[model samples]
Target: MRGLLPQLVMRVLAAGLLTVVVAAGWVLWDTARAARRDAQTTAALVSDAIAARPSFEGLAFGGVAPTPVFRDWQQFPAWSLIAPGICVELGPRDQPIQRRCGPYLAAATPPDWFVWLANRLGLVPEPVAVPVRTRYVSDAYVTAIADPGVIVTRAWARTGDLMRVAVGMAIGGAVLTGLLMIRLLAPFGLLLRGIEHLQRGDFTGRLPRLRVAEFDRLSSAVNDTAAALQEAQAARAELTRRLFSVQENERRALARELHDEFGQCLTATRAMAAAIAQSGESTAQDGARIAEISGQMMDSLRAELARLRPPDLDDLGLRPALERMVANWRARMPSVRFELGLAGPIDAVPDDLALSLYRIAQECVTNAIRHGTPTHIALHIEVGDAITLTAADDGSPRHGGTIDSGYGLLGIRERVDALGGSFVLAPVENGMRAVARLPL
Candidate 1:
C-alpha cells in the first residue's frame, strides 16, 4: 500500500504526458495544413480581384493604351485597398508600371524561419498573370503576385494561439487526471492502512466500505478475514488455557499418587526387609536382596516423577531447569556435543511461557538425537518483544532415509500453535534445524 500510491501516480503521469505530446503534435500538423489551404485560397481571391478591374477588361478586349478610362483605372487609388496580401502591377508585358499592396515589402513581415516554414507548407502564394489585348500589341499582361505571407503569417499567429490553448487544455487535463486518480485510489489507501493494522496483529480492525463496487468487495473480504482471524485467535487461546489446566491437574494427580501411595508402600516394605536382615542370620542374604530391590524401585519412581514435572522449574526458575535437562541429555548421549545460548531476561519469563518454551526445546533435542543422529547441537534462546528459539544439529538430515512423522514434532507444533506462535522444522546444511517464535 505504501508503494501503491507512487506507482499509480507515475503511471497516470506517464499516460497523461504521452497523450499531451501526441495531441500537441497532431494539433501542430493540422494547423499547418489548414494554414496552407487558407493561403492558397487568399492568393486565388487576390488574383480574381485584380482581373475584375474595368481597365484590365477593356485591355483584354482590344482597348487602346494611354486612353482616359485606362489611365484613370491604372491611377485609381482604390487599388491600394485591394486584398492585403496581393501585389497589383500595371504595365505592358515587357514593362513594369507600378506595384501596390505587397507583403514582401511590408515592414511587419515575419522572420525568415517562419516564412521558410510557411513556404515549405505551400503557404506562399505565386503570381497570377492577367492578359490584356492592345490594338497595336499582340501580347500585353498585368501581373498580380499575391504575397500569401500576410495571410500565412496571420494563420501562423492563430496557430500559435491555438497551440497555447492546446497546451492549456493539456495541462488542465493532467491536473484533472491527477485529482481523479487521488479520488479513485483513496479507498486503496484505507485498505492499505487496514492491512497494516492486521499485520501488527490488530485483527479487530475492519476496513470500511468504499464508493467503488470492486473496492468495497475487496474491503469486505479483508474485513471478513480479519474477523475470522480474531475469532480463531480467541478460540485457540481458550483451548490452550484449558489444555494447560488439564495437563497441570494430571501432573498433580500423578505426583500425589506416586508419593502418597506407591512411595509409602515401597518405604514400608524396605523397612521390613531391613529388620528381617538384621534380626536373622540364615535369611539375611535374601532380605538384603529384597531391601536393595525395593530401594531401587523407589529411586526410579522419584526420577520418573521428576521427569514429568521438575521441581526446579517451580522453585529455582527456568534457567536451572533447562540447564539440568540439557545436562541429563548430554550424560545420556556423551558422544553428542550440546551448546546452549540464553540472552536477555530469561528468568523473568512467565511460568507458562517458560514451560512451553522448555517443552519445545526438549522435543527438538530429542528429535535431533533420535532421527538426525547429530554429533553437535546448538540451542539459542532470545527474550525480547517476542521469544525466539532456534535449534540446529549437525548430523544426517535423512538419517537412514526420509524422515517420518512422529508424535514428537506434532506435539511441538501443537504446543507452539497453542501459545500463538509459529514453528518451523527444515533441513539445514548438515542435518536439521527447528525454529519457534512466540509473542510475549
Candidate 2:
C-alpha cells in the first residue's frame, strides 16, 4: 500500500502536464490564425485607400509625373503609417516595374522557427493587389503586400507567456496532489504499525482517529480487534491458571488419601495376617506366604501414591525431584539411556514454575518411551530471566500422530500459556523435540 502512492502521484502529474501542453498548442494555433485573418483585412483596406487617391490615379493615367507621385507617396502620413511596406509605381505593360520597398509591417520579426511554425499553420497572409481604375489605362495595378509577422510575433509572445503559466499550474497541481496524498495516508501508516505490534502479541497498541471517513472507519475496526484480542488473552491466562491450581490440588488430595487411609488399611491387614500365622495351628510356611503378600501390597500402594504426586517435589526441591524421576525411568528401561542437563539456580525458582517445568519434562520423556521407542532421551532445563526446558529423543519420529488430552502434553501447553510462555513440539531429524519457555 505504501509503495503504490508514488506511482499514482506520478501518473496524475503526467496527465496534467500533457493536458497543459495540448491546451497551449491549441491556443497558439488559434490565435495565430485569427491574427492572420485580421492582418489580411487591414491590408485590403490600405490598398482600397491607395487606389482612391487622385494623385495615384493621375500617375496611372500618365496625366501626372511619376517622380512627384512617388515622392508624395513615400511622404504620405496615413499611407506611411498604415501600409509602410506597400509600394506604388508607374511602368509600361511590357516593362518590369521596380518600386522602392517600404519598412516591414512588424516592428520586430519573430524567430525563424516561430515564423516557420506559423507558416506551417497557414497564418501568413497572401498579398492583396488592387487595380487603380482610370479612363486612360487598364493594365496598371497597385499591389499591397500584407505582412502578418507583427501580429503572429505578438501572438506567439502571448502564447509563450500563457504556456509558462500553464506549466506553473501543472507543477502547483502536482505539489498539491502529493501533499494531499501524504495527509490522507498518514493514518494508514499508523494503522500498519499498530497491526505489526498486535502480531508480536503487543495488543495494547491503538490506532489514532483519522479525519477521513474511510480511514477513520478502518482505524476504529483495528482498535476494536486489538482490544478484543487483549481481553481474550487475559481471560484465557486466568482460566488456565485456575485450572492448573485445581488439578494440582486434586493430585495432592488423592495422594494424601492413598497414603492415610489405604496405606493404614494395608498395614493393619499385614499385622492381622502375621498374628493368625503365629497361632499354634498355623504352619511356618503359611505364615511366611501371608507376610510376603502383605509386604507386596504395601509396596504397590506406595508406588501408586508416588505416581500421583511426588513428595520430594515439595521437600527436596525441583532438581532432586527430577533426578529421582529420571533414575526411576532408567531403572524401568535399562536399554534406553537418559541424560539430564540442569543449569542456573533451580532451588531458587518458585514452586509453581518448577512444577510446570517438571510436568512438561516428565510428559515429554513418557511420550518418547511409549511412542517414539527412543534409544536415548535428553532433558535440559535452564533458568534465568526465563525458564527454558528442552527434551529430545534419538528414536523414530512420531509421524502423523496427535496427542489426546489424557497424554499430558495438553496440560503442559496450558501451564506454559498460563505463564505467558511458548511451547513447541516438532519432529527432529532422528525423533521428536519438545520445547517450553516460561518467563521467570
Candidate 3:
C-alpha cells in the first residue's frame, strides 16, 4: 500500500547513502594503505639514523654502566627524526639502555575496534631493528617500532567527516526527491478530484492544464468527458421538466373533457329519455334522436382517448397510423392542404419510438391548424441511418412556430429529446419548419 512518492524518496535516500559509503570506504582503505607504508619508511629511517651515530655502537658495548662517551638521548642526531607512529630503542636485552617514542596518537583518539581492524588488516607496519656492532661482537641494537596507533585514529577521524556528509546528502536527497515527485504527480490528484465531482453528480468540474505530455493528454480527455456529461445533465433536466408539464396539461385537458363534454352529453341524453318515457311510446323519431346523441357521445369519448394515445399507433404501426392521422386532420381542416410523406421501414419501428414520432407529428399538425392557420402544411417522415420528420407550412408561423409560445411545441421537443434526437422549430422563407431526427 506504499505510495509512489514515499517509495521514490526511499530509493533516492538509499542511493545517496550507498554512494557515500562506497566512496568513504575507498578513502579509508587508501588512507590505511598509505599509513602502513609511511610507518615502515619512518621506522627504517629512524633506525638508520641511530646506526650512523659516531659512538652509537660503543655506547651500548659490554652492557656496562653508562660511560662518559654515552650522550643524552636528545643529543644524538638520530633522536630528531623518529617520525610519527615510530619508536626507537637501544640494546638487544628486554630492557633497553635508551628509548624514544613517536606520538602515541598522531591523530584523533580512535575506538578500540578501529585499532583492532587496522592491526588485523596489516595497516600497522612491522617493527624494524638495526644492530650496531663494533666488530664480530655485537655492541647494541637500534630498533624502530611502528607501534604507535595514529593510522587508525587518523582514518577514523576522516571517516567521521565522511559520515556527516553522507547523512546530510541522504536527508537532502530524500527531501528533494519527495518534493519533485509530488510536483510531477500533482495532475493525478486533480484527476481524482474531478472523478469525485462526477461521483457527486457534479459534471461541471474542470481540470487545469499539465506540463507533462501524458498527463496533459489525460487531463484533456477528462475535461472533454466532463463537458459532455454536463451537457447531457442539462438536457436530462430539461426533459424531466417537460415531462411533468406535459403530464399536467394532459390531466387538465382530460378533466375538461369529462366535465364539459361528457357531463353535458349525459344530461341531454337523460332529458331526452325522460321526455320519450312520458309519452309512453318511443317513436322511431325519438329512437333516432337518442341514437344520434349516443353517437356524438361516442365520438367525444374516442377523441378524449386519442388525446392520451392514438389506437392506430399500436395495432397498425407508424406509417399507417400517421396516414390515418393526416386523413382525420384533412377532414377537420378541409380548406387547408395537408401532405404526409412516409419513407423507409416505418412498420418495423420500435413501439416507443413510433409513439414519439407520431406524437410530435400530431402536435406539429395540430399547432399549425389551430394557431398558424397555414394554407398548406407539408409533413414528411424518412428513416435511414436515423429517423427524420420535418413539418413545414406555407401558412403563417407567427403564432404557433415559436417554441416558447405554447406547450404543444414544447411537448414535441421533449418527446424528440427523450428519444435522443434533435428538434428545431424555425421560420423558413415562406413559412415555419419543425424538424425532428431520432436515431434508430
The predictions' CA RMSDs to the true structure, in order, are 7.9, 7.1, 16.1
Error of 2 at 174 (Å): 3.3
Write the candidate numbers in order of decreasing lDDT. 2, 3, 1
Instruction: List model 2 lDDT by residue over 1-440, tens digit each.
Output: 45757876788789888987788678777775554454455445544544455454455676655322322444445444344334333333344263434454344456788778777876655644545455444565555444465556765676677777987887788889888888878887888898899888888888887888998998899899999999999999998888888888999999998889888887887887787687856475687678789899888887777767877898899999999999999998999999999999998999987877778888888877777678899999998988899999988776634566745677667778899999888888889888898899
Per-residue lDDT of 97-203 in model 1, one digit per residue for the tens? 76656333334455678667767755554555565544433444556555565655665565566666766666676667668878888888899898998897789
- Give the Cα lDDT of each candidate: 0.72, 0.74, 0.73
Please report, as a residue range, the 10-residue window in candidate 3 with the lowest summed lDDT. Answer: 64-73
> What's the residue-level lDDT of 380 in candidate 3?
96
Error of 2 at 157 (Å): 5.6
Candidate 1's TM-score reads 0.58
Q: What TM-scores do the predictions have?
A: 0.58, 0.64, 0.44
Q: Pick the candidate with the highest TM-score.
A: 2
In candidate 1, stretches whose alpha carbon ends up further than 4 angstroms from where it belongs are 1-81, 88-99, 102-120, 125-152, 172-176, 179-186, 196-202, 208-217, 236-324, 337-355, 367-411, 422-440
In model 1, residue pairs whose N, Cα or C atoms come closer than 3 Å (at least 3 residues apart or on different chains), thus clashing, are 59-133
Tell me which residue pairs clash in candidate 2: none
Q: Global CA lDDT of candidate 3, please? A: 0.73
